[model samples]
Target chain A: MTLSLPNLGLGIGWRAQLAHAILNRPDIGFVEILAEDYFLSETIPPPLQALHDRGVHIIPHGVGLNLGGAEPIDPARLAALGELAQRMQAPFVSEHIAFVRAAGLETGHLLPIPRTHAMLDILVKNIRQAEAALPVPLVLENIAILFDWPNAEMDEAAFLNAICERTDALLLLDLENIYANARNLGGDPVALLDRLPLERVAYVHVAGGYEADGVFHDTHAHPLHEEVVALVEALYARMAVPGVMLERDDRFPDDAELGTELDAIAAAIARGNIERHERGFAHPVLSDAS
Target chain B: MMSASREAISDTQADLVRALVHGTPVPAGFDEQRVQAVARSLVNKRRQALARIWPSLVKRVGDSFIAKFTEYGQTHPLPTSANALADGRAFLAWLAVKEPPTDDLRIEALAYDLRWRETPLGLCRRGGFGIKIARLAQSEKWLLGLRTPWRGDRWWGMPANV
Candidate 1:
C-alpha cells in the first residue's frame, strides 16, 4: 500500500535470532525494533549497526510507557526514548495506548485502560508529552487486550480515532489485534476497520495468534493467520500504510519459514491492489466465509 | 477535576525501581486478596502466551518476576542503580575471568540461570534456555558494556588504588 513514509513496504520485527541472516541478506523490508533494547547503551549493537550501514530504515516500538493509565509519563523514560530515537535516526517511534502500571507500580503486562473520556485525556496527554520529548512524531498502537475495562465508555475505534485526532499522533494499526478482538468479543472486524480513521494510520502490524478452545489469543508464536492478512488487505485499500511488519514473539521460524510468511503478506498486498476508492473483494481463500 | 499534571508518574511506577531503591516487595502495599487477585490475573494471561514457551518459569521464577523487574527498572533506569543489572553483569564478569566447574549440576543451574534468566527477554526466546553461559556473557551488548559499559549494561570497575 502507498503510505506517507518514504519507501514504505513490508518489513519484519527486528529480532535477535535472525540478526545474522537479516544483515547478510538486506533485501527484506524495513525493520522495527523495540525502543528500550537499544537505549541502555551508547554504542549500538554491531548487527544493528551493520543493518544501519546497509541502509535499513529502523523504526522503534516501545512497551513500557504505561501511557493510558492514571500515572504520568516518566521523564527519564521519555529522555531515554528520545536518546534512542536520535541515535538510531528512527523513522518514527510508537507505543501502545495501554497502561503497564496501576497505582504507581508496573503491572508488567500491557493492561487495557477504560476507554472513557478521562482515560482518553490521559493517553493524549502522555502522547503529547512523548512527542514533545522526541524529535519524531509519536505513534500509538492499539493493543490486543483479552478483557475490556469495566468503565469503558466508548468503543475501541472511536477511542483510537479520538486519541489520534486530539494528540495529532499517528496510528500503528495492528491487524492481528483487531482480528483477535473481533474473535474474542464477537464484533465485526471489518466494521471496526470502517470505524477507524484510516488516513491517520502510518504503519500496520500483522502477527500470528493462537486459539485455545475457541478463544483467539494474540500470541505471536504461530504463523500469520489468514484472517489478519485479509483485514490488512482491506485496510490498505483506503490508507497508504507505510510499513507492514510481521511480529513473532515465540517459536521464531527459520529464515525459510519467515521468508514464506513475509512473501505471503507481500503477495496478498499486491493481489488486493485495491485503490483508495474501490470496494475490493476479499480473497475467498483468506476470507472467513463459511 | 484533575489537571493533566496529576497523572505524572515519576520512575516510581516501575515496581522493580521501588523494590531495589526502597526494599519493597513486588507489589508493596497490597493485602493478600488484592495481591492474589492481580497475580491470578497476570498468571491467567501469561499462562498461555509465555508459559507455553517457558513451561517452568511460573513455577521456578514465579509470575511476579517480570512485574518485579519492570518495577526495579523504573527506578533503576541506569545500570548503576539497578542491582539486578549489576549482578547480571557481575555474573558475566565472573564467567569471563574464571572457569565454572563442569561437574556440579547446581553450578550448571546457576550457569543456566546466568545465561538465560538474568534478562527476561533472553529467557523468553524459544529454546533460549539451553544457550551456554560463556557465550551469553560474551554477547555483543554485554561485552561492549564490560569494556565501555553503558547505563543498562553491567559495569566492571577498576581497583580504586592502581
Candidate 2:
C-alpha cells in the first residue's frame, strides 16, 4: 500500500548553493531537503520557508538513521525527523536501507548492510518504529553499495521487496544508484529495473557521479553520463513515477550548468512517457512559524 | 535464536565498516579486490571532505596531504554524525598542533577559528569577522590561503607569526 504524496513535477535536491536559483526558477517544482543539513530547530529554516512560500514541496531526506542496524532505532533521532517533517509540511520523508553506524562506531558515510532474513527483521522493526513516530509516511531509499556481504541469501530486489512488504513502506528508487551498482558490479541495470517494485516508488532520484579506477562513485557532484541517462529513460518507460529530482552535494557548478542537468532530468521524464506536468498541492500548507 | 542472529549481524556489520575505514581485512566470501578498492575510495572521499573544511591545510600540506590525512584517519575515527563540519574543525585543531608549531599553521588555525562559527546549520562565517581577520593576519606577512603553513618552520624550530 502506497501513501499518496504531492507530485512536485521536476525538482532539485535542496542545496544552499542553488537556494537563490530555485526561488526564481518556475520549472522547479520540489526540493528534497537533506534532513541533517539543517540545525535542529522548532521552526522552519529561512531558505525552505522561502521555497514553501513560492508553492514548492519539500521532502526531508535523512542519511544518519541507520535502520538496518541490529539495535532498535534511536527515539531521539526519530523524533527529530518527525519534527523536521512537520516543520516542512512534507508529505513523506526518506532514510537509507544502509547503516550509517554500527553499535557505537560511526562511519560518517552510508555503509552497506548484509542482505539476510535477520537483517530484514531488524529493518522492519526499526521502520515500524519510525512510521509510528512520524506524522507522515517514511520512504526508505536504496543506497549505492561499494562492497557486498558474504552471507547474502537474496539479491537487492528480493531484499528490498521483503522490507517493503513487511513494513508496508514506500520506496525512493534512485536510478543513478541502480546504474552505478550495475556498472561497478557487472550487471544489466535495465534487468534490475525490470524486476523491482515501481508502484511502491513515491519519487525518483537522478544524480551524477565521479569515476576513478574504473569505479563510479555516486558522488552527485559530477555530471550524469549518457548510459545513466538512458537508464532513467528506461525506468520512465517501465514505471510512471510521480516525481524525479536532481541531487548534487559538493563542487557545485554555476547556475546554467546545474540548470541544464535539471532540464535533462525533465526531458528524460518525457522520453519515459511520464508527461503529467501537474502538481498535487492546491494551497500552501503552513505550520506555526513562531 | 533471534538474539544469536542479531549478534551475527552486529559483529559482521562492525567488521565491514572497520574494514572499509580502518584498512582491516575483508570478511569471507566477499570479493577482496572490490573491498580493497572501496576502502581506498572511501579514504579519498574522506580526504576530499576534509579538504573542503580545511582547504588551506590541503594547499599548505601540498603533495603530502593525502598521506598525512590517511595517517590521521588511521588513528582517529571520523565521526558519523551530521556534524562532519564540526568534526572537521576538531581535525584542524588537531592538525595545528601536529604541524610542527609554525607561524603559518598558527595563523591558519587562528584565522579559521576566528572567521568561522559552528552554528545551528553548519560552519558559517562569523558575523562582522569575515575579511577583517584575513586582512589583519595578512598585514603581518602571514598570507591567508596563499602561503603554505609548514614552509619555513624547520630552520628556527619555530617562526612565530608576529
> TM-score for each prediction?
0.68, 0.81
Q: What does the lDDT read for residue B100 in candidate 2?
A: 54
Please give the CA lDDT of all the candidate structures: 0.62, 0.73
The true-versus-predicted C-alpha distance at residue A234 of model 2, in Å, is 2.1
| DockQ of every candidate | 0.09, 0.37
For model 1 chain B, give the 10-residue run with minimal summed lDDT. B140-149
- Over A86-111, each residue of candidate 2 has an lDDT whose tens digit, in order, gives 88888899989988776466677787
Q: Is the docking of candidate 2 incorrect, acceptable, medium or high quality?
A: acceptable
For model 2, residues B66-103, the per-residue Cα lDDT tens digits are: 78777776666665453655655566667767855355
Chain B TM-score, candidates in order: 0.22, 0.59
Top-DockQ candidate index: 2
Strongest candidate by lDDT:
2
lDDT of 1 at A213: 60
Instruction: For model 2, state the Cα shift of residue B61 in Å.
Output: 6.0
Off by over 4 Å in 2: A274-290, B53-64, B80-82, B100-162
